[model samples]
Target chain A: MIRVRDLTIRVGSFALEGVSFTVAAGRYAVLMGKTGSGKSTLLEAITGLRPIEAGSVELLGRDVTRLKPADRGVGYVPQDLALFPTMTVREHLAFAQAIRGWDRTPTEQRVAELADLLGIDHLLDRQPQGLSGGEAQRTALGRALSFRPRVLLLDEPLSALDEETREGMYDLLRTVHRETGVTVLHVTHSLTEAKKLGDCIFRLADGKIGEMA
Target chain B: MSSRRRGTTPSTGRSDVPFLVALGVMGGFYVLLIVGMLVADVLSTTPGHLWALLKNRDIRYSIKLSLISCTITAILSVWVAVPLGYLLSRYQFRGKALLDVLLDIPIVLPPLVIGLCLLILFSTPPGRGVQQFVQVTYAIPSVIIAQFAVAAAFAVRTMRVAFDQISPRQEQVALTLGCSRSQAFWRVVLPQARQGVLTAGTVAWARAMGEFGPVLVFSGTTRGYTEVLPTTVFLELSTYSLEGAVAVSVLMVIVALVVLLIVRVYGMGSAPVGGR
Candidate 1:
């Protein structure tokens, strides 16, 4: 569960004030906005990557407003995918578990399970540079899901893909949501993406969020 | 070919052939000048002079001091450059531009002026206050301080460029993935900057290796103590031993070439991700 109430954030000359929203546990939510709208900023704030000026951010019944990003327990996939160029896909999937000091055997087992689920089993040993666009997307998705976080945040994950790849990813994303049942808040400018994937769609404009039919 | 096609490229190209020749001639002239200088140094000095200089106790001390001071300076410069570079590349804060200009001051200042400034600074009360504990003026430590003043500036610029090529996105993602700021830096950022750190060290080492003017004014060319390679050349030249100076300079040139060769072999890896 992710709940943001009356959140206020200032980024440069732009600001979002008195914004509020909620993604019920296990719901796939998409926030749609124009290019410069504060969608990414809001997502970053929820993930504790950015500071909030007012109100509260609650995840899994705990207030994480003043918490460091490390303690937020939210998996974030930024628009660029931000893959570690030095690590292979398997390493990337194993990273969170390793950082959190999970057991070695369980970490490997989780990596294998995610690779199979994301259809990246064949690309596990390969670096991110070798993966195609959809392959990279799946790799990043696998990495985000590997830790079994309560909340997942994605920023423009499919904006760079072709039409065919986007369609494939929509199905994969649905499958991921079904398999993990993690609360998701995906941000994008595309109404079609919002309509296709979101169990609940929210539109952000002029620094406020409104529910969409 | 049609007249238009022939007239467009081949004929026009022929007309500008002299312009191309002019550029090549100027470039070739500079290369030839460098080659000629090396050849003249080789011809004007004997292997015996180089061997004799190498055998001189004081000159051997100068070589050892040069290695020690240069190594220390390179290590110190990199220690300061990495975080300073990361700040300049990653964040914006009050006085950032002022800080940027301040960092460049050492790089743009005349080498002699730098030494003179250090001399004057040491005479001030605060400088004197530190000096009371450990003497810096005309001491061996001044050699490293002089080298660091200039060498660190170059290292800072290289590290800034290195950090700039790597996007902050990776660090942010690492933070989101249960790693603290320092952990993200150590595990994610530093590993990517491994080649860049080596490049900075190489540049600092090379710059400090050749530092002359500042070391001269600040540390002095004391025979058994403060002398470095470039000052050794100057010391030989001052004594009217032109052949010995050329031989010592030839050694400096060889060391510089080896450092350059190493930098070329293993420096400046293009970061695979990040940037604008």
Candidate 2:
């Protein structure tokens, strides 16, 4: 479970003020917002990429307000996916395990499992430049899941996909959540996406977060 | 059709006659001037003279010294440029703009003026205190120091452009994937910046190899002591040895061409992260 209590973040002229939310363990929580609603900024603050102006963040019953992103045990997929273009898909999957000092046999097993689970096994040797949009998204997701993170944060990851591909991704996401039992906080502006994916829905408006019935 | 009609046909395109002529004449004159000198030198100087110049004890010593000093200057330049470039690219603090402007001082100033400034610094209280422990001015060390001051400025400029092209998002993702700050920099940032570092190093080495005024003024072009390629050319010209001067100049031209070729190949192969 992830809890953001009275979280305030300021980025230049825009601000997210006194926002609060919670997602129950193993739930797919979708955060919906309009354009420039500071949704991405809120996600970045949770990932420790952006500094919080006020309030605290707690993850899995531990206060992670002052923790670094790597220490928070969270996987983030930005809107652009932000894949390391220079690294091959295999290297990208191996990166997190290498950095976290995971054992070789186990890390290799995890990487192979994620590659198979995400259907990116065939594209592991290719760089991001050679990948199609769906393949890149799956690779990004596989990388995020390689370390077996406690929470997954996605920001409009399916926005670039076509309607058909988006549907496939939704199913894949649902399967990922159900099988791994990991919490997810996905940000998007599409009502259909929110309706399809969210077990608990939170709407952000005017720098405030309110839970939907 | 008539000759006049043929001339007016626009098949030649709307060429700016005067502008094209001017560009051709100006560029042609400069290229011809350099080529003319090299051609004239080759025609006048015999193989014996060129070979003798190369075999001269003083010339050999100057070549060795120049190579060693320039290599050291290039390495030192990159060593400073990498961290300084990263800081300038990533952070914003007080006086950052001023510091950026200050980095360009050596590049903008005349080379002789830079040497003059270094000479004056070494004579000052703080510099003199350091000099008491290690000799610099008018010594062999002065050659490397003088070359480094100017070459490092160029290297830093090159590295800044390199770092500027890379997105901070890449490093952020690395950090989120479990890399510490240093680990992210070493593993992610450094690999991406490798081409830039090579370009900077080559440019710095080329600049250091050809630096003349600063080494002459600060290091004092002592024969067989601090005399580098540029200073060797100066010494040859001073003694009216045109053949010897031309030989050394030709050597410098060859070295510069090699360095530039390496830079071009590396740069073209590994275009900066965000660049076209």
Candidate 3:
């Protein structure tokens, strides 16, 4: 389970105040908000990229508020993918495995499996620049999962995809979630995606978070 | 016949043309000057003498010294510049504008003034006293220090611009991916900024290699020890070794050409990032 309490951040012209939330272990929670609604800021504060002026963020029953991102054991798939453009898809998976101290043979086998599962087995040698939005998203997902974190954070994972791809991604994400049983906190403004993928929904507006039926 | 009002704009004419022409002319002049110098010097030296000069002991030693010292300068420059540039690019703080202006001081200050200041400070007992630890007066250390000061200022400016051009979102993503601040920088941010950093390194190294005034003032012309390419040229000219001077200048031009080629390659790769 992941829990956030009294999370507040003062960015340029906006402030997120006293926001609190909880995600049951192995559940998919969607955060729905328009642009600049502090959805991304909340994610950042949780990830420790942005400092939280007043907050306690706990992941999988451990206090991770002061911990570095690597030590926090939460996988994040950013909106832009942030896939190292300089690296090939296979290399991205390999790097994640390497950083987590996975052995080479197992890492390679795992990477192969993930690539096959994402249907990007043929695109492993290619760079991110050459990949389509859906392909890149798959690569990013592969990278995040290779680390096998206790929690997964998806920041607008389906935003760049076309409608057809978005629908396909929803299915893919659902399948992956069920197979891995990884708790997910997905941030998006799409009502359709929220309704489709969210087990529970949290509406974020003007820096406030409220649970919705 | 209808008035053919196709694509011409009356207001966008003289305003742009005059300014662009002025800018073009200013840039053209430097290109011409450098080309003219390289052509003149290479032409003046006999091919045989030029070949021999390339093989000369003195020329070889100066080349080695220049390459080594300038490389050290670039490495140290990047070391100091990276953190400072990253901080300046990413955060807004008190006195940031003042700090930015201070970094620019070495770029615009006359090299002679920088040399004189170094000399005045280092030549005195107090300066010498401080120097006792590092022992920079009239030494290779002083040469590296001079090059590092000027080149680091240049690196800070270029690198900060490069870092600024990268989106903060990338680092944010890295964080969410479970990377610490330093890890995000090491894995994601630095990898993205590699070409920019390499270009800055080449430019800084070239500038350090060709450094003259401050080096001459601080580390005087001690052949085989303190002398670099430009200083070698100056020494050869005073000693009436015109062929040797021209030869050294030719070598300097070749080094600069290589740097330019590297920059061009980096520029091509970096263009797409900027376009985004």
Best by TM-score: 2
**Top-down TM-score ranking:** 2, 1, 3
TM-score between candidate 3 chain A and the true chain A: 0.97
Q: Please give, as one word, the docking class of candidate 1.
A: medium
- Clash pairs detected, candidate 1: none
Alpha-carbon runs more than 4 Å astray in model 1: B1-40, B46-48, B120-135, B268-276
**Prediction RMSDs, each to the true structure:** 4.1, 5.3, 4.4
TM-score of chain A of each: 0.98, 0.98, 0.97
Give the per-residue lDDT of model 2 (tens digit) for B200-260. 8988999999898889899997999999989988988999988788888777776667768
**Which DockQ-derived CAPRI band holds candidate 3?**
acceptable
Worst 10 residues of 1 chain A by lDDT: A138-147
Q: Count the backbone clashes (under 3 Å) in each candidate.
A: 0, 0, 2
iRMS per model, in Å, is 3.2, 2.7, 3.2
lDDT string, candidate 1, B1-276, tens digits: 455554344443357788899999989999999999988888888888888988999888888888889889999999999999999999899999999999999999999999999999999999999999999999998999999999999999999998998889899999988998888888888888877788898899999998988998999888888889898889888999888899988877776787678666655334444322
List, for all models, the DockQ compared with the true complex. Answer: 0.51, 0.43, 0.37
